[model samples]
Target: MICAGDDDEDPFPVEDCLFAETFSQDTAFTLFGQELRIQQVFGGNLGVAAAVWEAALHLCSYLEERSVEVRGRRVIELGAGTGVVGILAARLGAVVTLTDLPLTLPQLEANVSANTPSSGWPATLPTVLPLSWGQDHMNFPSDWDLVLCADIIYLPETYPLLVRTLAHLCKNTAVVYLSSKMRKEHETPRFFEECLPSRFNVELVHLDGSQNINIYRASLRKDLSQDLD
Candidate 1:
């Protein structure tokens, strides 16, 4: 699906891949029965945000297994590095949006454009936008069927903002599929402390052979984020 690291996925060097000024020529993968080509950029051009992480691959497989549920749904993939998960959802007929930091747009747009099935590019090409965590809340849509993301919790400090951002962007009824490779053990509990049993409901999504990695399914308990002043 979306392979980059070995099975015991070590933390990717974000400083090198995201902050280093460089370019990696396009690479292709078969995800959800469709092939995708991604053009990766690093350094000033882009960051770790442009590389296809291993969690993305696992998420792709997970989504493919549930394609029937995905079709015709309103989906958004945030922190959409290289757009693999979002593109996969689009391939399955979901109306999808791919969101990431502003710089990743070049690569995100390129990957979606080049890999879209020839017969359905216009309909399948996703809306690309910048969705910085914990920042502006006005730009994002309030309704979503599913919000998808992978390997987004590498930075421990951003966990609260990420949870808050999700609460703000998704409807109380929406589902969120978030996959995280445990780069730092403390990070997840920190997230839970910030989000659980209060603003959102969360559960572990067990997948075969991925004991170290976790796929968490979260949904808002109530639309309490809007009450913030």
Candidate 2:
């Protein structure tokens, strides 16, 4: 699965294989006028959550193009794989928390440390934490101003859990920005069409036809917010 760089004429090059074998590599991205070096680990013990996906890049472009203001806001990125989105949020002045499974925390922390230097803006570094959706979401406070999710809605099994965690974290005026690749085979459409709307007021904010990716903005429905209160 995971192959080395192109230099090795390996048939299964790991440059962008979604489910490749065990290999380590670094890729660079330019966002918000800064170049970010993202280290990606494939296969070994990691799942598809190790590489930087196109959905993440698409979401980052959306943020930058729309000039979304994240300055001084409390932002948390759920299922933050390579920490790119959260790191960009930090670069744009938001206090960010990049969270994922415990197994992914080490790489996430390393990415954060690499992109966000000590002299970075906002004066505070992005916090990396271990967060498994719906299991221990209660441990985190429900006071985020913005919740960022990139390419997280793929597994149908995690739909309920993901929604529960979203409802628990997005309280008051908090909003969730989720970017997902629309794969027909996967249950991505069901999550956007039915699951997410059941709990939050979901809206289609942006759509990338070329990539079949959509960016959705969601917030706790009035009734859901009342129930949470």
Candidate 3:
């Protein structure tokens, strides 16, 4: 996604992205070649961390196309609403950990279990957890090979901590894939400016199948990285 303050090219513009569809809590969809069902909570009952946003759709498709490279990797997905992106990663053969706010865990777990049922699911079903960005108490395994986040840069107040969390967890051997709708200009630029140049190399991915959403691949910079303490 184009950072809000960025003057660079806004590739893949979404001229008609204003109109979005509403779905029932339980719905069926296909990602890549896999057919899956998910349960999502919406309306007043759903929090920002629980809604199935558009960015995840595009992220899942990209994962499908890059399935081979994703296989056997240990992935951690932040703000994993409805568990869609992580579920797709699990389908792509990655060991995935899907996380959201504490309140969102039940819903994320439901979708993860529903889509990857025990009958057909292998022993490696995705793990669901509560993770507030920048919170050190988040109980997750270390050494994540890949980190995925979508639509998380909308809040400016959270950007500093969010970027810190991203950089901290993704220190070594982490290829971070971030997807988000390019909105709230200030927040986006703050995220890129605070985190990218020093600790990671950011690459904009041209996603083919979505509107108003962007994909970025951030590889940790080994040479220039520091704890920044």
In terms of TM-score, the best-performing candidate is: 2
What ranking of all candidate models by lDDT puts the best one first? 2, 1, 3
Better of 1 and 3 by lDDT: 1
Residue-level lDDT tens digits of model 1 in 1-229: 1212332332222343325446476888887668888777655445567678888888888776754378888888988978888888888788999987776777788888887787885345689987777776457877888999887876655556677778877654679898877654546545654554467788877444545667778887765645441
lDDT of each: 0.71, 0.82, 0.68
lDDT of 1 at 174: 75
Query: Sort by TM-score, best first: what order?
Result: 2, 1, 3
lDDT of 2 by residue, 1-229 (tens): 1222354433212345445567789998889887888988776555667879889998899988888888899999998988889998888789999898776788888888778655666746899898877788889998899999998877666678789889999866699999999987877899999999999999999998998999999999877885542
Residue pairs in collision within model 2 = 1-21, 2-21
- Which ranges of candidate 1 are over 4 A from the true structure? 1-21, 66-68, 122-124, 192-198, 207-211, 223-229
Alpha-carbon TM-score of each model against the true structure: 0.82, 0.88, 0.79
Which scores better on lDDT, 1 or 2?
2
On the 0 to 100 scale, the lDDT of residue 42 in model 3 is 51
TM-score of 1: 0.82
TM-score preference between candidates 1 and 3, better one: 1
lDDT of 2: 0.82
Angstrom error at residue 139, model 2: 0.5
Candidate 1 structure lDDT: 0.71
